[model samples]
Target: MAQDIITIFHGPQHPGITGNMSVELDLLGETIKRAETHVGYLHRGFEKMIERRTVLQAFTIVCRICVPEPDPNEENFARGVEELMGLEVPEKAKWLRTMVLEMARLQAQMLWFAGQGGSLGHYISPQWAVADRDLILDLFEELTGGRVYHMYITPGGVRRDLPEGFLGRLGHFLDYLESRLPEYDNMLLRNPVFLERARGVGIIDPATAREYGVVGPNLRACGFMNDIRKDEPYEMYGEVDFIVPTETSGDVYGRAMVRRAEIEQSISILRQIIRRMPAEKEIMAVLPKNHRKWEVPKGDTLVKTESARGEYSYYMVGDGTDKLRRVQVKGPSAVHAITLLEEMLVDSQLSDVAMIMNSLGTNPPEIER
Candidate 1:
């Protein structure tokens, strides 16, 4: 006799889900037999929207591509436009952009910690991680006037220069964040309960990771030394010093550990930026005198940035017009949240669904966009 197969949706409303996305699962005795990804709950049609707007107008909307980590979208958009226009960004602006990217990465990892812990019924991790993450948000709010979506990075460079004594405040926060790392390790990384649930589960074969278009920490977790920052240095990444951490296990715990190590790396990068940043007052490049009728040269260029989740890219075209001829985004979530996720869910227990999703750093808005 064959067992009855049960069909169910894992979310668009469930707390365990990473975002406004659902996975349809065909299950038998709590083990997933098949999985299908469903998106469109959040914002959509971002590429179309960008194509219809002017360069400046389009800049405002790219940040909406990924809510948790918007800076990468902004960076990609800015760099793509800059390349098309042949604009040279100032040295100071480059360091500022790099700092913002690293700050974004740090906060995003904290959010991941919250999701990873919450999915496994470890409530303490969320509370502690969120509280610590808020410190970075506070710095963002001070720097960019927005906590979540910072529309700070622009076409040629950053929107403005840093405020007075801002680096001093940032340095202090970095110290605080570094000091709290041990506490995070004790509560989550070293906790026996977390180890039992995470170890050896949701393992991704290193050989298959690349074939599935895996990037960022997920790829690194599988022992690949791939990182956009190192491979293709942008902004001030070429000037900074950092290592791409990796793990051979390719499991939930290995992914978690990679992120843990990256938090320290982000801190180190920020410290280097703070020390070596050029002392220049000019942050923005000169734009056309007429803002409403600004036109770029006829050309297209591709730009990529290493976001918190993975590699984010923008392909932009200009036909000598005020509006862009085309704008296309290739975010990591499109692959990770849909195809890779569906494949990983098969034959896995239902309870581990959210844990697996969170480990991949799945974000639905990126998928929908």
Candidate 2:
């Protein structure tokens, strides 16, 4: 006799889910026989909404494309517009943008730590990681006047100059964050529970990763040395020195380790930026005298940025109008959370579904956007 096949939804409301999304699973006992991703539970149609708004108006909302890491979306959108408008950002702005990006990466990784631990039935990691991440958000509030959705990075340049002694405060925060790394390792990375569950689970072959368009830590976890910041340098990335950490295991633990190393790298990059940042007051480029009527030239361009999750790209078009002719975002989660995730979930235990999802850095907003 054949065993009964059970069908169930794993998310869209379950706390273990990464975001507002669900996974449809067909299970034979506790093992998943097949899986399908379900999205659209978010504020959908970001690309369409962007086309209806002016260039400046669109800039404000792009950050919503990925909540955990918004700076990459901002950077991609700003760079795409700048390229089309032939606008040159000030050298100081480039350094500032790079600093913001690294900080964003660090905070997102902290959030990841929390999710990874929480998904595994460990609660202490969330408390520690969220508290530490809030420190970075505090700095962002001081720098950009908003904690979560910072519309600070704009086309041509950043919104404003750094506040007085902001770098000094940032340095102190880095020092504190550095001290906490060992504690994080003890709580999650070195934890025996995390190891048993994460190791050898959700393994993505190196060739499979490339074929599926995987980028960032997930790709690096598969032993690929590919990083957009290194391969395709933009902003102040070309000026910095850092190593792309990789793991040959290609499993959940490997992905976790890559992100952990990157957190240290992010701290190192921020220190370099603070020491080498140029002193210039010119943050914003000269726009048309009338702000609302500003128009970009008739052309199209694609800009890519290495976000905390992976490579994020923006393909933009201008028809010589205040509103963009077209704007489409190609975020890493689009591939990571949908097809790749569905495939990875099959043949895995139902209990590991959320664990695998968090390991992939899946974000529903990015998928829906």
Candidate 3:
């Protein structure tokens, strides 16, 4: 029997679709037979835009490209520029950078938790998850003066060192979050609605994940032990001790469980960074008076960091000029586009389309740019 193929566009602004990009889905009844992704709905000239701006100016703009997770871009850009300048970042700054990146990870995961739960039709869970996340953002507001897009981490070092008794306050917040993990378990993790909705949904197998170059929690959920923190160990990660969570299921539920456990790991990492961090940390470096013409020796550097979604890479090419010759960003959305969303949608119900795609944490802006 020849099934009728129905074409449906997922979203350009649909909250369920993650970011503002549409997907061309060919469906037979409720089953999606094929998916073609479109990305230009967002700002299309990100690379060209960066080349026009100064190195420091460009840093502020990079985060907007990938909203849900932005720190990795800051990290990669700062790291790339730093490598170009042969700048020696203070040990304290390195630990602090590691802490900041993980905090962003925790926040991104919080948002991911909410979005994933919502996608699977467990609406109440997102409320609880977002509520918990607001507290984390509150911490961000106090620390960086900005909750969502924190331009705290600059080229030389952070914008400023930890605030007065920042450690104690942060410690208290961490304690609060740590204590609330049990509630998340009761409310979302072990809740009947979530389990029923996510148990076997959006399943991505291990071999398929590896072949597609999946990274971070999604890949980890599929039983791959690939982690930039463990594998590369940048920003004082080598100094801390933490366990990378792994799951064998590779389903929606598996990723959820992995995310839940990973929160504990993030908390663990932050605590270690605080404990081992030096008291006299320099927030910024003394640079040349002329900020505009801040040129460094000629060199190109490729810096890759694992974000909430997966491995985010930045390729910085320099011609010994104040402005970067080229800055290229590579994110996990490609795999999400070609491998997961396209293949996973086939045979999946129309309703599950949003749920499945969002659960994968596909940020369209990353791919669109």
Candidate 4:
């Protein structure tokens, strides 16, 4: 008698799967034999849509590139435009941008902590992480008037200056987060259940990681030190002092550990920004007489930033028109979700699919885009 092979789709709607993406699996019993990634379940044609819109109009769409970490998208688009226009951001504006980026990292990591717990059938951390994450969202609301999409970081500089006494409130939030770090460790990071499940699952060797274009905490988990902020300093990153955390395991646990350490690094960097921010009245640069009529010079440029998941990059082209000639978004998810995920999923048990995907931080919108 011949053995049976079962075919299944692991979540476009499955809670185990992240976002709105699915994996087609060929399974022998509970073990996945072959896996294929399927995206495009959410928004699509982001690059093509960007090509048709004015520079200002296109700005709104890039934030949707990575729903969990939109500031990196904004930073990349703004910096790419600035490079093409020969624009110089004020020193204070750069610090503000840096602060915004770090906040995004912290919040994204918090959500990941929740997802990691939920993936392993632990409900406690998810609730705690989400509530803590909301505090960060509250700070964002006070700063940008929006909780999810701030649209605060713009081309030449920030959309506006910081509100009165905002830094003090931000400082308080950081202190509270620092105090809660111990709780995170006790509840999740140090939990024996998480350790048993995550320690050896989803191992990606360092060479294969690089070959597949892996970046961010996933790559760092393999014990390779490759951070755009450290290797290629941008904005205020060169000015501030921080460390890139890495792990040797290259498994789910390693990735989790790297992100946890990163949360602390982000907090430290945030404190440095608060201490050394420049005192300047000018935040945003003077736009042209007609903002919509402003055109970028005829040239193309690329910009990259370190987001919580990995490196986020954007390529832009201009034909001396108010509308962009082209805009390309290359987020970490493009590689992690499809190429990396499919490769890692082979021979993996069905139970580990969601845990591994969440560990890799694959966002479906980024894959579809």
Candidate 5:
């Protein structure tokens, strides 16, 4: 039996790999007997780097913690600092931040469509979904000079007020995205081949989800309807109306369905923001005369937000100095890419490794950081 087992590495470079990470698997023929996650290539010591930087400086780099969905990182870091400093964010700023988060969620979901579909050999999904996701990125570029980093969200509030006519454009885009969801459903969700492949694949036991610290859609797939927006009500989330979708299967199909349903919910949340947000108001809270010289009283706070994948959290500490005493990021992928990935990969066929990883929404950058 020992002779029958063969070990293989499944990439930091392979096309099927989620990111700059690899999975080492021991296989008996095509079935995996053991699996281990490997990560390091993308690490930049972000938490340590933030400790040496001022609050505003740290804001600029938090987005780099998670590439596929960066807004949640910015949100957690900013909110944590705000809590520590006793800074009051403007009401309008809360609405704007909420809008940004929802947009990021929708864009991330679109990117996930590409990854999940590509993993299952559905090329059409990537082609269409990536292109649509670009449309959202275009908006991001307009809002923040940088498309990917988007240091637009700072500790006090947003960097600037909404650009003239930004709301009108966003409304039209939301309408377009709403119309496109049905097409995505027909293309992937309802496809019999995809359905059959995903139905029972990478099944995660409901009992283990919480133990493994699973969050977001993966946890929701287990029929646990926990969402920071609904449960914690940060920013303007409490003011909006949206559903938290859930499924009982706790399998690849269930996770896929949860995300697919969530796209519509994000769209609905964005619509509510557009309708209820104040027409004119301040976007940023008061800042010190010297931004770099700003200091927070000695305190620590943990901020949590629901990212596209799961719960994204940041632990921040200040020592009554301009620089942070410590900053720690607990990305959702930390659990999914390691514990859940390794456990689920065992007994799985080689053909389903990518499928399982995608279903779990493993983003390596977060793990390595």
Candidate 6:
């Protein structure tokens, strides 16, 4: 037997950045010969957890799929349940949900900045990025009551209405972020070091990207403009005007530009939502008399939504009972784990591991669970 090549487990605790997960690598010297993903660390049986809980209880757990960017989980579960129940959300609530999703997008992008920028020996940019991200989270706190894992976006509608003058605070934050964009350009985007390291590094062809089902910034990096938010126009996205930024290069730098450009677009979308939102409307739909007793007609549904990382889908099966019969979460991590991460790791420098993982935004919890 060709003594199964020497392999080493790289994470789940070591050099975090990617969170609690492990990467099995077969290595020859510095080259990665093969890679296998493994982690039951957070295998919380989230789907089964969903099965035992009420529709409302289940929504709260799905966010754990990607803690760094959780709103999309809420949106999917909420939308799925809404469709099954035939609940019609009010106009204002629709707009508010859009605003919440956009805000989550911005937050996740900021965290991505921290991951990407720090991976390649740059620190200030990520620090600034994360610090600024806190402002948006502050807004989240006022609106939804939690910072990191917000259990706000529920089926039928949001948890609560926006605070008084919330738009004014949101508008100010947007202006602040907009003004700082140029500074980011000056410090990081224009820096020669960042350019040389990022420009042509980690190139992914458009065909491969599509075939593997890449989503979010990585998909856009391949010059494909496919954002479910824009293409499908859920919530109030149809009412807003914003462009999906894309790049032909499909490298680290291309993703950086795509994310940076989208920051402005996100802010602009928020401004539009604030302006277009109806002044008065019911925020939450009439929910079941008792959440624990809530049951949907026996059937199945798959809800798809664009998360910051990529295409996030929630598949639910209702057994005509309060508890769900089955739930499956299919996120972009599937590609990032078994496919893209494997292909991207061979012969790559040790330094690029984190950057590559960050660029892909692989959420281990999502992939394993």
- Computed on alpha carbons, the lDDT of every model, listed in order, comes to 0.90, 0.90, 0.82, 0.90, 0.88, 0.83
In model 5, the runs with Cα more than 4 Å from the true position are 1-3, 16-18
Residue-by-residue lDDT tens digits, candidate 5, 83-131: 9999999988898899899989998988888988998899999999999
Question: For candidate 6, lDDT tens digit of each residue in 1-369?
Answer: 444557888787743255677788887666677777776777777877787788877888878878788888888888888877778887778888899999999998888887777877788867898899999999999999999888888888887887899999999999998999899888888889888878777788899998988888899999999999887778887878999999999988898899989988998898888788788858888776788766787888888888888888878777787777887889888786668888878776555666777777877877777
Per-model TM values vs. the true structure: 0.98, 0.98, 0.95, 0.98, 0.97, 0.94
Per-residue lDDT of candidate 3, residues 147-214 (tens digit): 88988777877876677887787788899889988987887779887788778888887888888788
In model 1, the runs with Cα more than 4 Å from the true position are 16-18
Q: What C-alpha lDDT, on a 0 to 100 scale, does residue 142 get in candidate 2? A: 95
Tell how far residue 276 is off in model 6, in angstroms.
0.9
Clashes of each: 0, 0, 1, 0, 0, 1
User: Residue 40 in candidate 6 has what lDDT?
Assistant: 76
Query: Is 1 or 3 the stronger prediction by TM-score?
Result: 1
Give candidate 3 misplaced runs (Cα > 4 Å): 1-3
**Against the true structure, what is every candidate's RMSD?**
1.1, 1.0, 1.7, 1.1, 1.3, 2.5
Q: In model 6, which range of ten residues has the least summed lDDT?
A: 12-21
- Ten contiguous residues minimizing lDDT sum, candidate 3: 281-290
Candidate 5 is scored at a TM of 0.97
- Per-residue lDDT over 192-305 for candidate 2, one digit per residue giving the tens place of the 0 to 100 score: 988999999999988889999998899999999999999989999989999999999999999999999999999999999999988878888888766567788899988999
Collision count of model 6 = 1
lDDT pick, better of 1 and 5:
1
